[model samples]
Target chain A: MTSEAPTDLAIEVRGLVKRYRGGRGQDELSAVRGIDLGVRRGEVFGFLGPNGAGKTTTVRMLCTLLPITEGHATVAGVDVGRDPAEVRRRIGVALQEVGLDARQSGRELLELQCGLYRIADPAARSAELLRLVGLEDAADRLIGTYSGGMKRRLDLATALVHEPQVLFLDEPTTGLDPASRLTVWQEVRRINALGTTVFLTTQYLEEADQLCDRLAIIDDGTIVAQGTPDELKSELGSDVLTIGLDPVEHDRARDALLTLAGLDHVTDAAEGLAVYVDDAAGAVADVVRLLGDAGIRPGAIALSRPSLDDVFLASTGRRIEGGVPEMAS
Target chain B: MNETLLLARRAVREVWRIPAATIPALFIPVFFLVVNLGQVNRIFPPSTPFLHGQHYVAFQIPVSLVFAVSSATSGLAMVTDIDVGYLDKLLAAPIRRTAIVWGRLAADLARGIAVSMLVLAVGFAFGARVKSGLVGVLLLIALSAMWGVAYAGIAIAIALKTKNVQTTNASFIIFFPLLFLTPNFVPLDLLAGPLKAIARFNPVTYVITGLRDLVLFPDIHWGSLGACALTIALTGVALTALSLRALTRFSE
Candidate 1:
């Protein structure tokens, strides 16, 4: 949001905000509270969040699809609010929705996209894109006939037609099968390898950890945490031990875990408590003992190294539901 | 202009690729033309003064043309794009937003032209002839298609405002009263006093009269044609403006 954002940053935002005016008798809702971000020119930057966390709202504002309620954002060095056309010219977007026309063939849609972008020879550009997305074989087929993976690939191809400096892919693999999600991840890696700064948003934790060079985890209209996946996870500075319990007992569980030795913090997980500790092996016994002493029987108990979900829990006091890629489909 | 044309090309392609969308629109009009001629062709013979020396079918041809081309196809297409998220793709593209509405209207032009021709062909098959000859035929086609293009604005506006398939599709129902309020059954003078008064105020009456005059008369009736043209223009300007406004507000 700073006026003097370095030119090296592909996207820079300061105090970005979005609010929806509720209809008659309803109060206005703020979808995105003020947030700041600086994405470097050639890195895969992720906007990580749960549903309704304003990730899409922020992306929409930056993409100029939605007006900014307040704040400043410069995409590819052009102010999003002041000169959206230039930002659009430099940034390609594939929203959470596939945005492909079922009536048009993959080739036709690409050529149409090329023409819309004023590419001199749409035919050649479309062909090149089809090959890039490995959709050449299915290029002539109607988009309605395309498999989910094929459609997502073609959607990616459409965005790349202009060779934009920054590409925004919002949860590109949310509904994809595992194999297709991996293929899409590979495609993202390939696209990023070409020096295009990719801004991706996803609820999948592993996706952010594996794909993003850096990420910001947003929750309830605000960014709760951000960093390189390793930096963020390492910031937890301990192991995570998730103890399952009834939702009603979460408070009692939290109270019990509060005095455990080496405990850094305890956040409410969907099932129970996510207790962060210096040593999971040493603390697991204390955690169990404390819960047993509180007259509450714990359900399944699992211990693992810190993860992005842990970071989100640490920042927001609540775990992100379905945060792993394994739950995507 | 180029962006509009490109989107228009995509829209026109959708018109052909999706026959289901166009077929129902075409069918109902042709069916009415056939059934109306079957039921009333004898009652209102070519000798009926309102027939103006041509067959009753000729007198009714304009009605069918009006009916056939005045469809919710474009609006339905717009809603489909919204539902499937293709509209967002176009919105995000670095193109004039107005071009999206223009593109849809351009396809309406193409569709209206095709539908007018088929209705004319159906009229011809029913022993109807265009007295004003090929020129009249061309005028009829152009006027009908242009009217379609003009009337399409309402559907597009509704589609953009509602972004719902059922609501958008229901836009066609708004036309039923508009179509019948005119003197489609008989000449204006012969209608009941109340119906005649309402028909006199209907813009569709002018459109039908304009196209019908070409069919029943040997010369181009510029007065009726002018009123028809004026009606189409005013309707087009009003409706297109509304749809464009809707498109502008769509993202909000």
Candidate 2:
């Protein structure tokens, strides 16, 4: 897995690791254990994980902001360890924080960023970016005065100044309002359509499902699952029938449904019991009858296709949002 | 080079727009100068031997100039950048890392000049005159500004090393002793034995002495001026190297 060539991939990582040296009285900590990843060119690849799952750490290693303790990684066909400067030239990065100098006006900051990247005609380029981010009218206004959404958009524009081949957005819309998040999604689509590969790290399940062409779900510093949203969801090959019941009765429901036809498994859910079955339509009547024979009354029932949350639950025994594993019986 | 200039220009604009940052620094040094003159003006009359036929304000002008310009402004700004993540943005760029430090120091130079001019004006309004003439006045401003630029690297180094606002701001406190141990109050000979011995070894003494010479003497004191330039150059080299080293190891 560590030997895979990355010539055609936007980003490739093999057995990548990051370790923090401990100070006095503290033990050494490993943030990212060995992990392998391949992000195809011209696609939005989401690195999805919960907080403290090493999402930002991995992104930082790839962006050359943090050094890799071991293993090989490359961005834009350049080895990150061997030629980080070259990798930097070919990649753009917008971290979780907006990273704008609030003292400067939007136009001034963009122009300065353009100059740093050595773009020709900085003013024209700055103007073009301000328009791209829908900040043209506020170009000359200080960044301190811009709304959170405006600042995030301007930050996105700054990353696009050099037209980088690979752009890294770490939680691009993490703290944004719903409308701003949608606008960022549109911008991601627009950039990807223009042939730039995007590597986005997000904890939002909906964001990964909506924007990522493919994604890797990370848990506890390891890659637990990887695939397109549909592929991962379809792998479950079962419909989720959430049976609302008393928490104490979950084990009883699980026991009664174990012998039902088309049944895969049952897990304790937040509200009740989550029953996985090959044929939810066929298994519904059997589930109610079995629980009835056991003298348990079922409440509201919901049947739906497996969602990314379900996929995450299946892979890690936990829902991404809830961050707590449901007990399997 | 171009990247450095671009960043420096942005930093200068920050200095221009945020008058709040600079005004407080200016106020403290100017206030001290006024109060010190009020206390000691009659004692160090124009006819006093070391006064060299000039008012006490002329002798005190160089001290105020040094105090006014030596601030932790750039370091405070650097910590702010780190807090706001702007430094990370620059670090991820393809530009040379040293350019970031150079850019901040360039703004320090600009700030040093402006503050030096204001302090000089206050001295002028208070009856201080530069006997070494126009060239002396220009050199006085230039050298004061250079010292500020040199001293700024300490704060920057601290900011990069600690990456904490309070710790970085505390770097300026280290300058208090350096400023007091110099011949800031009177000529070196008039000081007490042990105090004079300590001031002799202090680098700031030469800087103050050289600047004071311009105000009191009729011509350039090449020997003291050379020592002053040499001190500023050495301090600049050492502190700048410390900051550059801190930046290189920032990720570690």
Candidate 3:
């Protein structure tokens, strides 16, 4: 758990590539083409992408769960392929799926996990983890009897019983109620606060923006953009003003918005035209007046500051499909 | 070794929680035992040399024990573990891989011994005797359980290779032929030439005969018994090699 190495990065990956060879006569599948990443020690570094974008594949390779097809990575200063056992010892991973033993109770699972790592005083360690996860009341009951949220908590607890130097959480809150999701976020923060490096992957931009200290926006199996949330938002350098127009008038609307003043540029969106402007307040009036002068009645119009979703749209040409509810900062 | 027991205990607990999973393996052999007992009672009287004055129920008891205890379903649980990603959790740990394999087999060994005792009890109630007495009974049970442990390797190998429930079940169904052709219905003396030749080589044959010798034969047939252990060891080594090889190639 000591960071004596010169480099403060807990993880360093370079040119990592993975390809799956399909069956005979079938084309090989490419999951991850190439990606490079650096995660600093004791920080929650989020990996965000839409589903099937190879986020899970990248995590698996880093955790030594899957063999890398090309390139390499080091986790906690150990080459993942060369010293996977050391990686296993240093990292605790909660996979995308909650793979708990349905027959075992919460306490039993913690005991098993601690035993797997040969941690001393498994009984005491399991008791502590159970209480930490707020599952003390249900610790003796079968995991199958627990609710979805309880299972998630137990999974997180199991992943942390070893006090790992680095923790990897894959979609930790994908199927939880808002309260449970918040609880997981708090747990992740608490883990990172204790000096454990956190590598989290999620499709939810809001989840990433809220929990991650810094993040990478991954699309199409590669990093499109990476920075702190504030820095990434500043990359847009302007607010997005969206004007919803009739599908029939979309072409004319695009042309009409181009002549407007105080607008940086226009990008046609799925529903309407998006105008980037230095000041949304000044641009909205011009937007309404310009459309009105053209005898066009807008379906709707809204202005919002840059969000990770906007950053995602800027990089990927479309908003993330996580259906995230973005709150104004 | 402690890790092995830890894994073994986990396996056993999973099986115990889903008690329904073991019902077919436990009771199907009882069906065979009961059905054979009624028919054989009418066909082979005590005077019949086929039983050699030993109770017909005694002659058929080993078959039922073998059939029941050696259901080859240990790998079915292994497939479920793989499918549900529980195996991944264990693999990510720093434990020895052989512990994972042997731990699963230990649970099957327990189930085999449990069922073997059940069949032996039923045979005793119906006048089947262990002429060589308690040690003979223990040997019979141990032999039956060892076969269970051995065939468990085959089931586990199939599970690891396919990682599909349907394929694992079909593989278990195919195991019937292995036992049926090995003199399960009649002793080798009554078997026809081709079946007798096959039985001469069928490892299950040695397993059953070894068990029956401990029960009905005048003295312990060390040749048959030693053959039983050797054959079990051979099948065990081959199937274990297959499973471990599959494990090494896993997620490659």
Candidate 4:
């Protein structure tokens, strides 16, 4: 695994795919279609996808937990299929479920992980990680007694017990409270700052936008878009103006807004209209004037910068769960 | 190696944390030993050549020990680990894969040995004596514990293959019929026909006979004991291979 660090890419995948066969002569289901990606060293990379979008499967393959049906992948310069043991040695993974052994004390669990990795001075390392995760006081307590957030922190600490070159976290804070989520976000930033390349998968767009240095939006097992958060958002345009209209004259309002000179794109939102224009400030008056001329007085109007949801809508044609873009089914 | 021993220590710690895991396995043997002796002694088959008015309790102690050892061989904890994601956690780590199975089997062997000593004490309390002295007692416990580890392969195979707690439990339940159908209640000499025919081939018959020789006989019968050891060794090796294969094919 340490023979040669191949280029600067910490993770490289070409046409990666996974297919699960259905029983009783049913059609096979493709969990992850062919996907090509290269994640560079020392960057927090995010994989954003809805439920069942193959995020976990891709992570599992990279971490050497799942067999790749068709494709080639390398993590930390080691071929995953050729030497999964080496890939496992170079990578750390905290799975989606945070599966801690309940019978073992938190400290005992970390020590066991250190033992598995054959780390030196496991006792000293376990104490250091316990303090790092803010579980020093509760280190001796059985993991079964810990709260959800505590378990997550312990999981994170154990993943770092080996000092892996790359770390993979699948939905690290999916069910945590706001404060707990913020704590996990800090841990991710801290880990990335320490030069450990982090590959994160999160269902929450906000979490991805906040924590990710670069992100890929995965849909239907295929990556729909990939870039930094701002790059992806700016790809859709500068600003979005949401115009609320009566349910009766929605078509007329859309037609009028489409005719505006500065508007780049117009979409039918849930309540009213969403128009993307290059210069929102310069185009607001034109929007009002056009709608007023059409006798479709808007009940409410707003001009704002386009969020990640807008970028998501532009790419996937459907919003991420609980977005500002008209929670339409 | 070290990895296997460490994992085995972890399994032992889990058993320590949950005392209830060993209670049912241990109690079943004690309960059966007492109930079998009380009921069978009253049946009064004085004409029987195998146990004719002798230490019938010693003959029956091994039967109860067999049950204790077999019942103690379950892999429910392993199944629970699979269900709770702990198994996946271990799989993702860098360790020898066989350590996972060895760890569980080792813990069961430890429990089986403990239960054997406890039942041996109970047998003595009920007036059953071992003519082969203290060494015989140790050998009996060691042999029973060995068989316990050997028989555990069934549950371990099911656990690894199915990774379901209920399914592992169901497999253990299905194994009970074989226990009663063998020469458990009566000596093979008194039995005739297909029952005796089947009992001759059953591995349990050898295990019970091995334990019975140690208890009622004056000296060590090397020939009979070797047969018992060979059967256990063969069964243990076969089951270990099956379970190890299941461990290797875990991803499927």
lDDT of 1 by residue, A55-136 (tens): 9999889999999999989998888888888788888999899999999899999999999999999999999989988888
lDDT of 4 at B118: 86
List candidate 2 stretches off by more than 4 Å. Answer: A1-6
Docking class of 2: high
How much is B171 displaced in model 2, in angstroms?
A: 1.3
Please tell me which model should have the higher lDDT, number 2 or number 4: 2
* Candidate 1 docking quality: incorrect, acceptable, medium or high: medium
Candidate 1 shows a clash count of 2
Better of 1 and 3 by DockQ: 1
lDDT of candidate 4 over A291-325, digit per residue (tens): 89998788677888887777778777777775444
DockQ of each: 0.71, 0.84, 0.65, 0.68
Predictions in order: lDDT: 0.90, 0.92, 0.84, 0.84
Which scores higher on TM-score, 2 or 3? 2
Number of the candidate with higher lDDT, 2 or 3: 2
Best by DockQ: 2
**Candidate 2 per-residue lDDT over residues B214-243, each given as its tens digit:** 999999999999999999999999999999
Clashing pairs in 2: none
Q: Give the winner by DockQ: 2 or 3.
A: 2
Clashes per model (N, Cα, C within 3 A): 2, 0, 0, 0
lDDT (Cα, 0-100) at A102 in candidate 3? 81
- TM-score per candidate, chains pooled: 0.92, 0.98, 0.95, 0.95
